[model samples]
Structures are given as structure tokens and as C-alpha cells.
Target: MSAESLTPTETLVLLTLLAEARPVSNTELKTLGPELRAASRRKLTRLGLVATDTSVRPFTHELTDDGWARCRTLLGADTPPRVAPPVRAVYTLLRALGRHLDRADLQLYEVFAPATEEVAPVDDTSPTVEGRIRAAYRELAREPGAWVGLARLRSALADLPVDEVDRELVRMNRLPDVHLNPEMNQKALGDHDRAAAVVVGDTPNHLLSIEVA
Candidate 1:
């Protein structure tokens, strides 16, 4: 569906997810602005604009890659029909920002990027290699338990020894909260993705996820 076809509530939901740039629960969505009830959630999922992980209690929602693209289109779009004045004002400003971004050649991800919460600080002898791995995962994943590509994870921990990182990943997978999964779409695997995979039980797992406390 085109951006123009989206209802005001749907548009708001997309905007909220874009602003968050992380997995948000339906409950939290209410507090943020839009209440993403069953109908809207299903519609977005069907349209490939959102991904909902229902495996966990209080299912979490995040924007898919297509969702991000759709949101970027909204930057240049006119405000949806029947929106209130405040929302129209938001779109007015968004259009202006979109023009500036276009002139500046900045992608939306560069502007609405997730903040790095944990990383290897310069102080030596503090965080262990395992600790560093966890930090890297947090920086990359949309939420806890979200599947993060191993290739991206390894890039974040580039300073560490490759063997050491792989060994720790194997050990961490045995934990209850940690999981390693193979990319089901094997055709999408590039050389780097294949090379970065950690083999577990003879399976080359290309994704890593750790449940947050």
C-alpha cells in the first residue's frame, strides 16, 4: 500500500516506531501516543510494515526494513487526510526536515539512529570479553531477544580476538537467555555473514539473541 492510503492512526504508529527505533510493546505504544490494537497491528504486519514477535509475553513490535522505507517516504508525503491540526503541524515540520535531509544527503537511519547504551570504555580490566559481547548485542538489537546478525555483532566487537569472541558465543549459547539461530533465508547470506557464523551442534548459526533482564 502507498503511504497516502494509510489511516491517520496507522501513520502515527509508523511515526512512533520510527522515533523509537526499537521494539515497543503494545502497552508502551499507548503511552507513547498511538494504541496499536489488534486491527492496526495485523494490518501493518500484513503490509510488511511491522514485525511482531509473539513468542514472548506482552508481545513486542518493531519496524521491519520495509517499514523503515515506508516511514522515510512519509517524510516527503503530505499529511494524511482528516488528521488534527497538531498532526498536520508535525507533518509540515517533517516535510521541511525532509527537504533539508535531501539536500544534506543524510539517510533517515543516520538521523534516527539508536543511541549506544553500552560499549567498551577505555578503562582496562573492567568489563570481560563476555561483557563486551553483551554490550555489542545491546547496541545492535532492536530489543532483548531480537535476532541480531552475527556479521553485525562481530563488526561491533572488531577490537576483540575473533577466536575468543567465537568461543564465548558458543559458551553463552548454553545459557537459558541466550540463543543462536541459523538464518532461514540462507540465500540472503553473504560471504561475511557465513564467515561470522558460530557453529553450534554442527549448525552454523548466523544470528544471536540474549534476553534482557
Candidate 2:
């Protein structure tokens, strides 16, 4: 992968291989934890920065010769970057609403597509969709002190198709008291708007819980 495209863990894997200077067993790469190291190794392999030493029973991996050069380049970069914090879709909507924009809600809604973000899994034995949502909400959201993870909640109440949950969550966002994805990208509502906006995660803000007013 391009240096810029590497995820943190992937970068670490490259760096680790550079440091070890020899093939390391997958078990040994567990210095960064097995799950993450394995995942990073997979990505690194795809990018041609790492290769598996299949000569052994269990596979081991190490950086390629080019991988060493990539590491050197990353280490040599000395320029400081001028970058702004990423902007999130929900926060963008929040700012528009704060400004009382005529069609801000509609405009922002078009992007997040929370209505179709996820579809609940099917299970005929569970309660009705609405009933499940209500029950899950009550149990998990006596108050949104801690955000209930969307995926976790989805699994908790997976009887309905995920799209049904997404639709309800989108509708729920309309409530003044409820804040879907309230832990939004931080930014000033007025002024300080930037020339460009970038979304960081695939769906970092998707998981949500309600908050008390």
C-alpha cells in the first residue's frame, strides 16, 4: 500500500518487519496482538510490502527488500502537515440545523442515508420490529451515558431486517431530544467552516444511542 494509505496497524507491521530484519513467525508478530497483527499482515501482503515464508509448517512473514525502502522513506519524511480535523455527516447536518437552513435537513439526510445504512437480520421468533426497537432502546438507553454501539445493538435486536432499524434511527435523529450519532465530528457551528470537508472512517458515526435532554 502507499505509505499514506496504510492504516496505523499496517504501518506498525511494516515497521516491525523492518526492525526484526528477518522472517518472524505469525505467532511472534503477536507483539502487536494476534488479531491486529494478522490483519495488518494480510493488508501488507496485498500491498507487496510483506511476504509469507511458507518454507515452514505455520506461515511466517517478513518485509520485502522494497518494504525496507518504503520504511526508510516513511522515516525520512520531515515536513509538518497542515491538516484540519475530519468532518462527519451528522455534524454537518447539526451545523445546518443550527443555522436554520431552509433545506439543510434534507440536504444532509441525502448523504448519511441512515435509512438504509443497515438492515436487521431476520429471526421469526423475536418480537415485532418496532417492539424490539422499543425494548432495546429502553434496556440500553435508560439514558445515553455510554453510547450503545450500533452493531452491538443491531445484534441485540436483530430480529427485524437491519434496514428497518436504520430507518427508525434516521427518524429518531429528527427528535430534538434524541441525538443519533451525537458524538459527532467536532466543529464550530458558525464561522470556521473550511474550504474542504473529509470523512475519515467508513462508518465511524453509525453506531449510536439516545441522550436525555
Candidate 3:
């Protein structure tokens, strides 16, 4: 669905759900005090931005694949200006970064530092190594191939200490091979990737030219 057609409430609702990956009960949503949770779900469903199965009690709401994609697009469209406060800019950058990494990679970062009150799975109790790695690649698939190099990847870790940067790179490099895909080429790279690369301000020629095996 197009962002222009989505009401403010629907947009907020979808963003809330995206922040919380698991299924959210109606009661849980009500606590958000948005007053439009139910209405937003109904509206989003009509727009095919969300799926609801009232077959069971309490109802279950989850964003469909299309819903998730639409949400990402909307969020990208509405991103605040770069000159915004540091905290807001950081959050914006993280969301943009999430678009390029795999789900596992996103989850790993969230597991270590969730932006919201939600908690990620504890270490040792999370998904299999392959599962996490595939998630990371899924995130990367959302971006352009040219931005998935060591330098660009390192910039995503700028908030970390010098020592932590190497650690993160090591971990990212070792993600399960199954997650890598040759089909995610340059076209998939979005404006956010370019902006991030620019912000980092040091593109390594060798890293940008490397091909995925």
C-alpha cells in the first residue's frame, strides 16, 4: 500500500508492530493508548498492509510480507532530516542499516541493544546460528550490493568502540554462508545506503568491488 493512503494512526500502528516482531495481542496493543489500534488494524487490513485472523480468541495480528515492505517504505519516506538531533539521527540510521542487514543481523543488534522496551532473545537461547545468519542476509538483501562492503559495514558500527568494531566485523563476516545471495545486486541498494556511505565519508574501493560468493 502507498504511504500517502495510510492514515497517521495506521502508520503508527504498523510501526509499533514492526518494532515488536512477535504477535501482539489486542490487550497488549490497547496499552499503547493510541485509541486507534483496532481501527488502524481494520484500515491496514483493508489496504493489505496487515493480516488478522480472528478465528482464535483474542485475535492475532501480524504484518504480512507486503505489510512489512510497505512499512519499511513508509518509514524510509518519512525519515527526518539529517540535521535532526543525534539520538534521532542515530535511530534513523539504525533503521536504515536494518534494511540492509539480514533479519538475524538485525535481531543480533537488537538482542544486544533494542531501541525500544522490548527485549530480544537471550544469548544461547536464540535461533540457530544459520537462522541468525540468514536473518542478517535478509536485511542486506533490502539494500544495494555496493554498500555491503567492509568499510560501509564498519560505518554501521560507528557507535561501537574501536575494539568493538573489529569484533562486529568478525561476527558479521562469519554469518552462515547460507544467507548470502548473488541475486541481491546494485539495484536493491536504496538512498539510505548511499546516505550512510556518505556519512561515513571513506569508501574503500576494494571493499565496494568485492563480489558475493
Best by TM-score: 1
Sliding window of 10 residues with minimal summed lDDT for model 2: 193-202
Question: Model 1, 1-213: lDDT tens per residue?
Answer: 344377778888988988877788878888997898888888899998989999987888987767877887778988777889989998998899899889986656546643442322333344677788888888898989999999999999999999999877865664556777889899999999999998653367899988861
Decoy 3 TM-score against native = 0.41
| C-alpha lDDT of residue 12 in model 3 | 62
- Which residue pairs overlap in candidate 2's backbone? 118-162, 118-163, 119-161, 119-162, 119-163, 120-161, 120-162, 120-163
Q: RMSD, each candidate, Å?
A: 11.4, 17.0, 14.2
Provide the lowest-lDDT 10-residue window in model 1.
116-125
- Deviating ranges (above 4 Å) for candidate 2: 1-4, 32-39, 78-213
Considering TM-score, which of the candidate structures 1 and 2 is the better prediction for this target?
Answer: 1
lDDT of 2 by residue, 127-156 (tens): 565446546765776565455555556667
What is the descending lDDT order?
A: 1, 2, 3
For model 1, give the RMSD to the true fold: 11.4
lDDT of 3 by residue, 18-101 (tens): 665445667766675234456666777887777787887677676665666665455345444443364366447657756655
Residue 133 miss distance in model 2 (angstroms): 73
How high is each candidate's TM-score?
Answer: 0.56, 0.33, 0.41
